[model samples]
Target: MIAAKFQTFLILLTVLAGTALVARRFNIAPAILLMLSGVGLAFVPGMPPVELPPELVLLMVLPPLIYSASVAMSWREFRNNLRPIVLLAVGAVIFTAAMVAAATHYLIGLPLTVGFLLGAIVAPPDVVAPLAIARRLNLPRRLVVILEGEGLANDATALILYRFALAAIMVGHFSLPLAAGEFALIVAGEIAFGIGVGWLSLRFRKWSRDPQVELTLSLITPYVSYWLPEHVGGSGVIATVACGLYVSWNGPLLISSATRLQGIFFWDLIIYLIEGLLFLLTGFQMRALYEKSKTFPLDDILFATAVVLTIIVIARFAWLYPATYLPRILSKSLRERDPSPPWQWPFVLAFTGVRGAVSLAAALALPFTLPGGEAFPYRDLILFVAFGVIFVTLIGVGLTLPPVVRWLGVAEAGRTEHVAEHEAEIAARRQALDAALKSLDALTAEKEISDEVMRLLRARHEIRVNQLPDSLDPAHHDVSAAGTALTRSLIDAERKFIHDLLRDGQITDETRRRIERDLDLEEASLANREYREGPL
Candidate 1:
């Protein structure tokens, strides 16, 4: 097992290093690169299977990954898009599960209980995967919001459904009325837990001035919030999300910038490392699927994959097609004006439904034998299908996303000025260095600064200020331009790393404080892309 883990680690290093170097030098999604590498590694010989405990899987991989995604998501955006996210995450999960479960049981001749279990497992898309691509692709803010919000919330919804399904399977019965009551109770409980935790976390931060204690307290929030709901027989997934949203929205006002940046950075790296390892594990387990099935049904596995993938993709549109406009239509009758837009580009959203670590964790968590000691019917089938869906979505979406945007005119025609503006922004940024060097003239007050000090300062100053073409006009430079998107991402990634240390409680509060200020300044420099591109 140790050798297997080390081998997994080594492969991840090669993949991440390759992604870092290429993405650093050129503009592209590192996720796409990573997945492609996984695909390539699969075809190559000598890649060993990696089997990990479900407990280790969730603990090691989830907290940081979920936290990082939550931090980047603006509270304002999430609230604005809440309804749609609910449709996708809450309403959609049940809708899809029912449809899939019904189809699976009757069509495939599986027991109703096993069928629902199948439905629950495939309900949520990979949250980490889409964000990784969205960052690199420069997807529209609103669209990205829909994806992220739905992705985050849906994970919880899926988990809740899974729990209820598991109970039904174990206890030898399920009640529609009882399920309804349980659903209502779960929803109420989750809301109460989330709202309560959010308020408590904010109060803790507000009352506590010590950044060290504050950061430490914050680290425990996600896990505690997550499990609190679970312990009470509620949904932990939703609870963690609620806690994250609450903390993020409240943290800025109560928590210092230094602490926030530190937390953000620490979690970013933690998630990346976790995801990279998990995906490689996701891929490595292909052989396990084959081995687990004694009466192997290649045709059955293939059929299941095709069916599950079909349900996931179709069910998204199944919910989205009407949900998008039903609210608008209702509101139009009561309001003076109708302004909301139709849910365009269903194809883009549908295809982004990649499964990942979460699904694997859930599948692995399944009981080897049910309460009656009968074999978990078709356990290998579910894992294989889930894995196959993940592969299809990751590659399918990654490759087609760019064109889908273009085809849908998501990249507004005649307005793709980002590439050029990015180029110009890179050039005029020299003034930043010039300002720094000018500010340095005051640093020599302690002494006619030593020659070595002067030399070092001047060299640093010159390296920056000298890079800009001396005459490049800043006035004409496009403020909306994004330099090679890849470069921007790498810079963001590095900044995130510095903070991840703080978030994980691995660094001093003092260091977190400093990095927070740096993050703010860096953010300010690049924060106006929306205004730069739009009309009032």
Candidate 2:
């Protein structure tokens, strides 16, 4: 069984990689493409059925994905947009779920608990699809930040609500006050436990002083964050997000530069693989749903899917506009701080609530049997609808989002901010050059470095300093850009020489690798001076 599982996993990985490449080449959303590929593969002859067990997704997939996203989010921006983030993450989730439940109960004729269960499954927008596409688009930074913050935190609310609704179904009773208290306690415990775990992990990594060891610890930290709170009957999603935020904020002070770089690349690759697999698994779900959904009339299933998906989409708009404009209307200070964006921005945000891996995982996690030994209510129907909603939102809305942005003329509101940020980066580079020069002077004064070494170091810094623009003047900008290009070309020439030497067997493989690592780091430093791509 183990070997067979491994083989199947390898096959899926290959398929994911292939689909991702194709999607990228065509500039299409890879999640949708990969999912389509999975669905097609499912129907192939003699292929083993693919199943993504909920426990596996919640345990293995959710933690690192959540942690990486939370860490990558700009804490400053998240704080700045706290009002919207909170409204969307907490308020929007509740509102959407409630509306979905009501619609499902009345329009689709499902029981209230089952409707709530489906609501909870579909409530949280999956960050993966929107974020991946948004990064490529020239979205307003504030919009991106709010979306990311909501994505990072919203899962916790939806998952907690799902648990409560499921429990209510199984036990045949629930108390509002009790549920409220439990919710508060779970959130509190998750926050406290996550912070405690993150602090300890950070300290341990600092003490070890080994980049590889620290990287390994970073990999496991999210899992530990998740498991600890879960073991104590708290929300693991909240625990992981809190832990990620704390560690990322403190990491610059505690972690070495080498470890930070390595961690970034490692987490990027990990997320890419996991995210691809998730979409693939989502597609695989269609097969199982196809077989089971036949128990219900096909037209009824279609009706439920359309009604549920429509409700989910409309519910977002219902919550977003009030959530967005109300605060600015009510608070004079807020109005000044965040001038209300045009109505189109909120509409775009509402449209961007694309659901993905999380919803599918939650749906799949439904219990097969209740404690009373009765088959779980609407299990097949729920799965079908969940898959249907994911497809509609992830593919349909995702495809339309870019064109809609163009149509609304809201595509490039961040242009001025982007320019200002670039100016800041150049200024920082100049300061960095000055700092390097001062450090060389100090070393020379202490006789710790020879005059020749100091001069060489000073010269390099001078060259880099000369290449940076002192003003935002267009002519100066052109010169600075040209100089940067020249610098990169010189670096490329050095790399080519090294490659030639290695091809001619002049250096050992290990030596070549060491040299390549240095060159890569240098290139990364140069690229970051222009623009930093943060964590995954």
Candidate with top TM-score is: 2
**After superposing candidate 1, which stretches have Cα over 4 Å from the reference?**
1-11, 22-28, 36-48, 203-212, 333-338, 413-475, 478-536
Residue lDDT tens for model 2, 1-536: 88988998999999988888898898998988988888988888887898888888888898999999988876677777888888999899988889889998999888998899899999999888998887666777888888898998898899889989999999999788998999999988898888888899999999999999998999999999998777766669888888888887887999998898888889889999999988888888888888887777889889988998888889999999988889899999989987888998899889898887788888888899999899999898888888888988888866888888888876667665666777787777778878877877777787777677778887888777765656776676566566667878988999899989999999988998899888888887778745532211
Clashes of each: 11, 0
Q: Write candidate 1's Cα lDDT for 74-146 as tens digits.
A: 8898998787788888888888888778877776777777778888888788887776676455655666788
**TM-score of model 2 vs. true structure:** 0.93
Q: What is the TM-score of each candidate against the true structure?
A: 0.75, 0.93
**What lDDT does candidate 2 reach at residue 156?**
88
lDDT of each: 0.70, 0.85
Cα lDDT over the full model 1: 0.70
